[model samples]
Target: MSRFLFISCLCTLLLACQHSPKKNYFYLSPISEKTVTQTSSNVSSQLIGIGPVDIAEYLTSSQIIDNQSDNTLTMSDNAYWAEPLDKSIARVVSLNLTQLNNGRSFVNFPWRSDSKPHYSLRLHVDTLSRTGKNANINATWELIDNDAKKSILRRNFLRSIPAESGAKGLAYAYSQLLAELSKEMDEALNQNP
Candidate 1:
């Protein structure tokens, strides 16, 4: 009886050790209304599309990456993105642009041809990673006039924001970076329009 009981306990322990913990999923959030600066309503009627937002190859994974040093990057095993990072970024940027521009209409990519937007914003993210105590983003963006089929404005942005110690902090920092980028884009549109 004792031998049988010992074997059963060992089996239970082994099974328990094999069970993996639940993964934590996170998503990028939009900027709060309080942080948004009100702009003139003249451009409210313009329909803008945010799309073709590309990210670095390393960021395509669902795993969140943290840069321990200049040379070391750690992909989190237990933390995951709720959706594709590139799509999330495009969605968040669209939302932010709507808030910043007040009555402006913004849509993510994949709109029907009949409802094409007047202007399209294209973004390419070179780097978006948490390094040490900061989250950094480097990107190049262009605004194209769809009617003329020409590029009007192009710019590059690099930003590093202080981040907290965990994945949540890193996500928040990235969100803030996007918000700042939206502001810059809004300014560019106002200048060109």
Candidate 2:
């Protein structure tokens, strides 16, 4: 009886130790409805291609990253991104642009060869990390006039937004920053077009 009880207790302990913590996944949200509605009337028949968003090496991980200090970085084990961060950024930016400029056609990268766009937007993220209280994004974007075969606009954008607390909050902050960037891009496109 003693031996059986000892084995059962050990098995239970082992099973408890093997249990893993629940993981949380997060994705960036699109622009708010108010902003979308206000700008939705801006119509354009041009097709814009958004793609080839390049990000930093550290941001390639599926885990959410936090900057503990200026140099120290920490990646969350329990919090994860639902999709690739670069792809998410591109998707959100594309969605926000669509909302801000209704009637304008936007397609992501790798569109059908025959369905070429008039403008191509490319983004490169140099920094996208969150500290304890804020999240920061530094990036450069270029808009190419595919028909003209020339670069029309090249600009760098940097924003620091206050984050709430956890990984979810950081994700929200990032989304806001992307929306702002999209608005700026829309303004630029209107001017150029």
Which predicted model would earn the best TM-score?
1
Summed backbone clashes in each candidate are: 0, 0
In model 1, what is the error at residue 162, expressed in angstroms? 0.7
Clash count for candidate 1 is: 0
Name the candidate that leads on lDDT.
1
lDDT by residue (1-193, candidate 1, tens digit) is: 9999999999999999889688999999999987667775675578898988999888898988866576677987688899999999999999888887776788788888988998999999999988888899999999988889989988999999899978888888999999999889988877777
* Candidate 1 TM-score to native: 0.88
TM-score of 2: 0.87
Expressed as tens digits, the lDDT of each residue in 1-193 for candidate 2 is: 9999999999999999889788899999899877575454344466899977999998899989956577888887799999999999989999898887776878888778899898889999998888668888899999988789888889999998898888888889999989989988888877876
Write down the RMSD of all candidates, one decimal each. Answer: 3.2, 3.1
